[model samples]
Structure formats: C-alpha cells, structure tokens
Target chain A: MARHVDVGDLVDRARQRQPRAVARLISLVEDASPQLRDVAAALAPHTGRAQVVGLTGSPGVGKSTTTSALVSAYRARGLRVGVLAVDPSSPFSGGALLGDRIRMQDHATDPDVFIRSMATRGHLGGMAWATPQALRVLDAAGFDVVLIETVGVGQSEVDVVALADTTLVLLAPGMGDGIQAAKAGILEIADVFVVNKADRDGAETTVRELKYMISLGRREVRGASWRQPICKTVAARAEGVEEVVAAVAEHRRWTESHGEFAERRRHRARTEVEAIALESLRARLSARHGEALDGLAGKVMAGDLDPYAAADSLIADIKAEG
Target chain B: MARHVDVGDLVDRARQRQPRAVARLISLVEDASPQLRDVAAALAPHTGRAQVVGLTGSPGVGKSTTTSALVSAYRARGLRVGVLAVDPSSPFSGGALLGDRIRMQDHATDPDVFIRSMATRGHLGGMAWATPQALRVLDAAGFDVVLIETVGVGQSEVDVVALADTTLVLLAPGMGDGIQAAKAGILEIADVFVVNKADRDGAETTVRELKYMISLGRREVRGASWRQPICKTVAARAEGVEEVVAAVAEHRRWTESHGEFAERRRHRARTEVEAIALESLRARLSARHGEALDGLAGKVMAGDLDPYAAADSLIADIKAEG
Candidate 1:
C-alpha cells in the first residue's frame, strides 16, 4: 500500500484506454491514497470530455440488467464505456460485489468497457462523497461515456443526480414505482425515466402514470427545456434499449445548448472541492483539539452541556488558540 | 419560524409530558433551528434517563406493526415510548408520513405513546446526520424509550446501530433477507433479530438461516457479553413481542453492567458534537471564501486544477486570510 505511485504515468495509460491503468486509478480513489491529489491533478487536463449518466431505481427494478443493456447499446455505436457501481445490492459492497459482478459480466472481457465498484467499506466518506472524484477519473480516462449506478435508497439516489450529467430513474410495472418515484423525490431529479421489464404485466399503466406525474411535476421545472422522457424497455431482452440511448443523447444536446451542461459541471466541481476541504478541516480539528473534543463529548455525555453548545465551545477554543 | 422561541419554557413543558411541547421541540431539531443550541442547553439537564432502541430492516418486514406492538407492551408496564422514523417507505418522507401513519394509527390516540418522523427533505443532512439530535429531543422529553427506525439501505442502517443501545434487525420469510442481511453489512450490527410475520411459510427457515449467519458473524465480536437473540414474532397480532421486550431489557442490563452502555453514549456524543462543529466550520469556510471557492471550482471545471489541489489552495487561502 505504501509503494510509490507514478500518477502521471497511470493517467497517460488510462487516457490510452489501457484497462488496467484505469482500474488502478480508480483503486487509488477507492483507497483514498496519498497520491490522490497527484492523480487528480494529472487527470484534470483530460476530463470534461466524457458523458456521465446516472441510473438509479428501487431494487428489483432490473437496474443491473438495464445498466448492462445500456453498456451494450453504447458499445454498438463503437463508444468506449466505463461503469462505477456503488450500490449495496449492486455488484459492489463485499463478497456480493465480487461474486455478483452479475449482469455486468457480459462486458467483462471487452477492452472498451471498464466496470469498477467504489466500495466505501468505511473509507473517508460515502457513495455521495466519493462519486464525483471517481467520475472525474473515468471522465479523464478517455471513456466516451460513463454510467454511474446506485440503488435508489433514501438519499443516495438523490445524490446521484448531483454527480451525473444526465440521470435516469428506472421503474417497472406493478412495483407501485410511480407513486414511489413521486414519494422518493426522484421525480424532479431525473433527466430521463426508464421503465424496464416493460414486458411485465401493467407496463402501460406504469408508463401512463409516470407520464401524468411528469406533467404534474413539469411546472416546477418551467425554465428547464429538457423534458424528462419515459423510455420503455425489456432490458433483459435488449428491446427498446437504443431508444434510451437516443433519449440520453438528446438530453446531452439540450444541456449543452441551454448552458445547463457547464453549469452542472461547475456544480459537481464545487461539491467535490467543498467536500475535500470539509474533510481536511475535520481532520485538523480532531488532531489539534483531540483533548478538547474528548472533554466536550464527556461533558455532553454527563449532561453538562448540549451537543450544539459543546460544538460551539470546541470551535471557539480552536479560534482562541490562533 | 421568525417568532421568538422560549427554549427554557418549551423544555420545561416537554419534560412535563405536554404532547405539543414535545412535538414542537422535535420540529426544532427537524428544522435545524437557529435556537437549537439554546434548546439543547435547556434539554441537557433532563437527558440520559431514556433507553434508545433502533428498529430497522428491509421494507415490509412489519417494522411499523412490530413497533406499534412494542409500544403497547411497554405502555402496559406504564412506560412512555417515542418513535422516530426516517425511512422513506415508512410513515415519513411526505404524504406517506401523514397518510400511512399505518399500523401506528392504533397508538395515535395513546397520549403515552409518541411517534415522529424526521424528514430530511433537503434539510441540513441525511437521516444519519440528523438522528442524534432528534434522539436527544426525545430523551430529554422524558420518554422511557426511543425507537429510531430507518430503512435498511446502505449506510443508514449502520448509522442506526451507532445511535441505538439495542438494535433489532427484522426480517420476513421468503424475502431472501437472510442473504441481504449479510451482504448489506447488517449481520454484525444487530443486537437482536426479529422474524416478524412468523405465521407465514418459511418462517422457520428464515429464523434458522439467520441464527446460522449470526453464529458465523459472531466470532468477530470476540468478547462481547451480549449474545444476539433471534425472536420470532407475529407482530400484527402482538404475538411473541413480549420476548423481544424481554430481550431488549436483558441486553440493556448487560451493557449497563459491562460499561458498553456508557461507551456507546460517549461515542454517540462524540459523533454529534463533531458533526455540529464540522458543519459550523463548513459554513465558515463558505461564508469567508465563497469567491475563492468559486475561483477554485472554476479552475477544476476548466480542467486546470484537480479538486484536491483546488481544495488545498482554498484551505491555504483561508489560513492566509486569517
């Protein structure tokens, strides 16, 4: 783990589409290596070229199948693709991550497709915190497109919308997903919606419900020109997948023309920068005021002070020291 | 929101078991109010008398039903109970919160029982970040027990363990939850297991399978005094819920005797205080260096600086400004 890392050399190889180099760079991100700045520095010049698409939905909605099919769809156009999966149930967390590289196995041997899992495993931060940096890694690696997939659980799916240029919210019929899509607050986040497993019963009803929901929610995004599209697909059979591809491309065009593209990139950059700085500040506080924090936590534990007041005292002590 | 808040008076009323006062205090926590520190200061003296319990698992494992039953069991013994739910599918997260107060309706009129949902709906942080404050509110308000229920998704369930004294992981048969429990990194987090809906087919299989998984995972916790128990429950009928209550009490006794109880409280305090300080520092950095962050973010957006280097530059600027 302490070996000297030649970040520049790795970036060069990754840009050349050398698969191992791409995987190694992502490992550095996943591992939170000391050379992360060097790697990010080296990769920055080559980024902002790839399209980042986020795919998210409830479990059992065929998210993995849709991701695999989308990979194939992109590859059909001779485009190189990269996938970064961080979902708990996705091919990512532990033994399941390795064993169930699952449907993504279809493109395992393709030199043009790179699939890597960013396991938090209690690393520096969470899926939301690590994603932008990973996206930048793939973006700079010369992948024509990168698809980021996360399970639609709680705040995670909402975070995906921040890291992606175009976000797809997937649903299947009979999952009561239309109401779920509304409830999860994902209706406003999606750039496109994919109704996978469309061959299943009640597909039409799900699609219609989503369409009506879209119309209802459209007023909120009045100035935003990209109308979220509903693409129906039997992803298991690869039916209607190309239309999703077409829909994503159309979304990219709208974002690019409307200034939303660069704005989204800036927002992503702001989040990544702020998170890194916040983590650095947190480390500094703990290291310099370890005893102060212990005393404060003890005070809170003993009911001598509330957590917020202790927090204020700790910050004041830090400032007073200066 | 702009009205002057009488924090001390409110805390007095809440501790006196005035329902609206209790509800008002939690809303302050939920809203991340400016008066939070004052509220916390007032509540601190009344804290630490309540036991905190965490109820979590995959959706549809009858968590609400089990929770309602547990409230009844505890109320029968003349103990007041408070429930804080943050799960998206649970009686929280929007209309579902007010709409599907669901099985909890049984306890709606029971003044001795209180249920509140902490909605993150784009508030300060995710459920993980906001839960401790909410728990503190419940604890100081004189509830005998606080049950924090979050959807078992990714990192949120793990967060619950850090907040709970006795964490119950629930599962329904035929849901493949046995495997999910292991894969989701929750097997090690459970203090007790509940197989709810025990009348259904495969209930025995689920319980047996969980026991096997727990045994396999137990070696890691080497010297822990508490042996994780599997309690079979048909919560809808309140069957076997007493065993769960008994198990929770027994586990509490072990922790209180073994110093684990105090240690857990210390850890929770440390997390809460640090989060508050970190958030304060984040606000400071953004307030003082908004333009600098914008400049660094633009550099990253333009591929001139990687996010980490930009982060470093921003930090250096902050120190220089000081």
Candidate 2:
C-alpha cells in the first residue's frame, strides 16, 4: 500500500508546490504512517516560515465563509494559502461535515490555494497529535499563510489556538453570547476577535461583550504589552476582511516585538515532543501489560480487588518487566 | 479544607443512603482528590450490585424526558436510583447543560432519587477517566440502578456504552439520521433502541430507519441471539415507557445468561485500570521530562532537531533515569 514512499522525493516535490505531494505528506501525518518519522526529518528544515492563524467559534458563526474570505485576502497579496477545516466529528456520529466542502468550492480551482477538510478520526485526542504534522507539511510546501478552522467552540477550538500564533474567535450577530462558551480557558488563548455576520442585529453588543471580556482578561496578566483589536465582517460578501488581515498582521508584529512569537512556537514544540514521547512510552507498556490487566480487571469486576490497587499492579509490572 | 475527613466515615454515610454522602463521594471522584485511592479501595467491595444504564443521543432527542420517565418507572418498582447526567460541555463554552436539570425537577425532592450534572472538568479525556469512579461511588452507595446520560452522541456516548449494562440509543422523528451519528461503533453497543418524541411528525419513519439500521447491523457478528426491539415513546408524557423498561430488563437477563455481563464489566475494568496506570506513569515522567523536553523543543523550533528525534531522545532519557 504505498508504504515505500520516498520521504525526500515527496518533500522535494512539496517544496516545488505540487499539491498532490503536499496532500500525500499530510495523508502520512493523518494516517499515522510509519514514514512520518522520515517525513518529519525531511520537512522540518523548511517549516517555521509560514504564519499559522486559527479561526474558531460556535457553529453558524460563519467560520467557513470567513476562511474563504481570508484565503482570497491572502491570495491577493500573491502568497500561497493553505486551509485545514478541522471538523471535530462526534466520535460515533462519523459526521464528516461534508457540507463545509461545498462552501469552500470557490478555491477548488485555484492552484495557489489548498483546501482540505480533515475529520478528527479514531481517537478523542487524534487531532492534537496529527494537526501539527499536517501544518508542517503545509509549511514546508511554502504556503505563506495557513488558516486552520475548527467547527464548534469545544476542546478542539482550544487546541486550534495552541497550534496558531494568532487566533481569531469569531461570533455572529444576534447570538446573545454570554462568553459562557469561551469557558475561562479560551479567553486566555484568543489573540484577536472577529464579529462575523455583523450586518445582522446585536453586532455592536457582541463586540461590547468581547471588549468587556478582554478588559477583564487583561486584569489577569495576559500579553500585557499587546492589545487585541476586534474586527467586524460579513464574510459572505468579503466585507471588512482586510481589517481582519490588518489586525492579524498587527498582532503578529506585536508578538514578534514582545518575543511572544518565538516563545509560543517553542512552547508548542515542547508539547509536540512530550506528546510523541508519551505515546511512545505508552506503546512500550501496552503489549506486556495486556494479559496481566485482563486478569486484574476480572478480579476488580468480581469485587475481589480495587481499581487503584489493580492499576498499581499494572504499573508495577511495567517496571518489573523492564 | 476537608483534607482530614475520614474516608471510612464517608463510606459509612453513603451506604446508609445519605444523599449528602453520595454527593460528597462523587465530588471526590470529580475533583480527583488525594483521598481517592482510599475512597476507591473502600467503595470497590460494595460495588458490582448496581445495574448501570446509559441513555445518550443527539441534543433535543428527549434524553432528559426519557430519563425522567425511566426514573419514575424504576421508583414505582421500589428501587432507589442514581442519575449521573454527565454533561460533556464544550471545553470553552462552559456550557453546563443547566436546562436539562429543570426537566428532571419532578424527582428532585425524592430521597430515593439523586440527580447530579457533572462537567467534563479539565482534560479532553476527563469524562472517560472520571465517569467510572462516579459510577462506583453510586454503586457502592446501594443504588439499584444508575442512569448515565451524556450531552451528545460523541465520544462520551461511546464511553457511556462501555459503562452501561444496557444502553438506550434514542432518536427523534424527522431528523433523517442515517445512522451516520451512530458511526458504526454505537450500533454495536446499543442494546435497546427507543424512537422518542413519537407524537411528532416523523416518529414511524425514525423507527423504520432504526429497524433498517439494526437489520444491516445484524448481518455483522454482533449480539446474534438478541434482536433489539425499538419502542416508540413520547417520553414527555411517559407514553410507551413501560415497554422500553421491559426491553432493558430483558437485555439484562440475556447478558447475564450469556455471560456478557461479566465480560463487559471485566472489559470496562481493564480500560479503567489502564487509564489510571497510564496517568500514574505519565506523572512519574512529567517532572524529569519537563526540563529536558523544554531544551529539545527549543532545538525542534530552531529546526536543528526534528520532533521525532527529539521525542526519541526524551523517551531514552526516561529509560536512562528509571
């Protein structure tokens, strides 16, 4: 099955902006193929040149429309653009968000733009593990700006913020959002705010709520030197999109000046390394622990042993076997 | 502040059917308090007596209405029941699902019924790790049956299926669900199907869809001896609830006679024990891996070291240190 992919040749083709090569590289990352190690080695040097921006918000906040607008904005500047529509499908629902692809058809015929819809397949934490790799593939392929849009303002949204240098938290007018969905964590991660569908009612109030939340967040000592700007857009018409582009560029300049840009990237790399290492360790313990855990599970099920004690025995076996 | 509280005393109170004690024990499990090992050891012996049922579906499928109906049915049978309404709130939305609580107000004052709504606290995998502990607390406290209902038909629903002795997958009329949300995995886990909101426009169509999906599922190697019966219900009025309750009872009898009861419990215990052990191993690696991984991450960011190489070095450090 294409297991014998030449990593170097693929990276070379991707660097020349071959869309299929880029797709193949990203597929390796998504599938967790064995060649990922080699792909990473080949792609690493060419990454870190692209600017990563994450767009996240509640469903119906016009994320796809906004993403299309942003792609048009960046492409006008003569820069290649890459889009990852990361759908956090209900693990059972197999809900692939196929309709989103229809919305992005505007860019389908453009050679300079790569539009992809990726599902969080198999595991709850699957996207977190695979997304950075996909970003690396895009980055190495020389996409000047990569826009990552995730559906829903859930854990996946927060994860998108971690992967991006600048995060745009979008909201639609008339939603009467209480910032309750921002959960205390997203308030810390959002770099810029975008009020999409601003032509509708309550747009000003949504901006007011975001402003109030930002002021409240400032008191808690976040990027104190950089003030985040709020931009309004009717992305369906590409109205006020340039203002968002300006805001992102401004945020980038501020972060670079404050050294927060490098710090964020380094921090992201640390998380990436730790996750990969932890997964490796987990795999090492799995085979040996399987049979013993089955027996211990039976004991616990019968009320003959507690779970905590059984867990200890399982971990203790790992040490003894090693 | 309650650090010095005696685990044995709490267990004693919980066993006497004290709602406060049951609530307190669940809080410990939710908060992951230091006394958990003691609480788990104490509760393990008294567990294994409760029938755990999981009710999950897409939002607005009348899960709470059905839950309330089931609670009434079980109470009429003179059984004390515990309801763990596990709300998998969007990690950012802080969405607590408070409205569902109001629906269950009918049984709020009854000493025989205890209802609690728990948020997926911090981690993405938080629900999977904590739900079982909460179930054990309720099981140990002598509840005849425990209903575990989650917000969405996502990963949390699948987790509920793993925890449930009988899983009721509910669907509403006119939703046109293609078993797409069931995602192949839930179809294998659902023991009983309920077409809720039967008084609505498309109830019969929903039931027919379920039957078709079940028949399609039967062609595979799943529960060959048991043909899952779909009961149409307007749970808001408790119509047709008795049939659904009878279906669950029949399921319990089948699982018990077929030995799937012990097997499922054993499988769940194995998963629980593995999660706890992995968490333990993860903690042991954290302190040491933190400093080294930070430096490696810097290199990875600088492109001098690829992430895979950095991860390998980090894991090697673990083996060397241990």
| Pairs that clash in candidate 2 | A93-B181, A181-B92, A181-B93, A183-B92
Q: State every prediction's TM-score relative to the real structure.
A: 0.90, 0.81
C-alpha lDDT of residue A178 in model 2:
37
- lDDT for each residue of candidate 1 in A160-187, tens digit (9 for 90 to 100): 5557889998888755546555665566
Docking quality (DockQ) for each candidate:
0.43, 0.32
Clashing pairs in 1: none
Using TM-score as the measure, the top candidate is 1
What TM-scores does chain A show, candidate by candidate in order? 0.91, 0.91
Q: On a 0 to 1 DockQ scale, where is model 1?
A: 0.43
Worst 10 residues of 1 chain A by lDDT: A89-98
State candidate 2's DockQ. Answer: 0.32
Q: Per model, how much of the real contact set is kept?
A: 0.48, 0.42
